[model samples]
Target: PVNRLDFGTSGLILFAKSAEIQAKLSKEIQEHRIERIYYAVVRGVPAAASGVISLPIANIDGNRRINEGGREAETFYRVIKAWQGYSLLEISLKTGRTHQIRIHLSYIGHPILGDLKYGVKSDFINRPALHAGKLDFQKSEFKIPELAAALPEDMAGLLEALQA
Candidate 1:
């Protein structure tokens, strides 16, 4: 069931016990039947309470970048909470692309706290400050499984810091 997570993202990762199941789930993902939700601690509060990021993404050399020539990528996000100059965001994906969330958030002027690639430098955390909070797979035949994960210690600590 293990699907891919960003290099810096931490949380529940789905893993298939067997290749057959993996293929089935992969097909479902391609068909847009799977949902991936993430939580992030980002820098700067969003001007809007909630919104969608619709953009195309492509790679520039070895790095992923938002480009008109790239594939269409869509992400929806809401500000769950906000602090002095930071925010807690609940984010979901409509289309998956490399660094989609990170790049999109950065593009919108709210790069993740620890995501130096697309965000400003920070000492608040050591990583991108993103977590795979939940996942849902639409099924009709048999019980596939339940997918959800709690925030890891590092992320939780960051939240506490923001709260104070």
Candidate 2:
């Protein structure tokens, strides 16, 4: 996959028509020219309105965790909205490591809702309440059309209930 989201994550997954494009895009991603934003409903309200998580991640027993041996992964997140016990976050990643967002959020005691692999399970939904909200490649050489995906119904509904 040229770009990927976690298995239970729903939204845009970029695909390159050929390996050459894939290579170019990979380099662009590495240079931090690609813009990817995500949305997730988490277990608790963050104390601050926004903050950056600069945690290195290492895969241990098939799970990603914060470790010194891992590469630097940075995730910027802001509380979009909040209700008792939960908060919606708009997140952007500076490094694309497997489960980077999930790991960072979970480490902060705010695991994504229904993300059983990380922690906390919500019968409110079966899968992790995460969505790849947007993609921006405006600065890249490629003319790939920009993508902006809406939140899935299940997640949207969950937000509604929380708001209520």
Candidate 3:
């Protein structure tokens, strides 16, 4: 696969037919040519409606956390909606490290809702409320048009309840 989603996260994934294609796609990803967009329902509204989270993440005992010596990770987030105590975010990544979104959101004090590893679990959803909503390959050599997936039922239901 050219890219993978975190275990419980849902969204578009890219797969290559051959090793050569995989290498080519991997290069595009490494060069930040592919656009990845995610939607997450987080626990609380951030003080700022939009901002960037630039932090380094390291894997320790299989868990991802912010560490000064870790690889550089950058996450950009914009608050799409805020209701009750929760906020919906549209997030993009500059660097795709393992668990980058989860760790960055948690570090910023607004962990993704139901993300037990990084934040408290919630009744609204069993797994982290994150979905890979869009992927744009326009900037790459592949010439594939942008692809998008609607939020899965679980996430859409969670949002409906929140909006109620």
**Which candidate tops TM-score?**
3
The lowest-lDDT stretch of 10 consecutive residues in candidate 3 is: 115-124
Clashes of each: 6, 0, 0
Q: Per-residue lDDT for 42-100 in model 1, tens only?
A: 88899999999999999988989889999999999999998898899999888878889
Q: What's model 2's lDDT at 80?
A: 91
lDDT (C-alpha) at residue 97 in model 1: 87
* Candidate 1 segments exceeding 4 Å error: 138-142
- State residue 46's C-alpha deviation in candidate 1, in Å: 1.4
TM of each candidate vs. truth: 0.91, 0.93, 0.95
Best by lDDT: 3
Clashing pairs in 1: 1-14, 1-15, 1-16, 2-14, 2-15, 2-16
In order, candidate lDDTs are 0.85, 0.89, 0.92
Error of 2 at 89 (Å): 0.6
Question: What does the lDDT read for residue 122 in candidate 2?
Answer: 84
Q: What lDDT score goes with residue 117 in model 2? A: 86
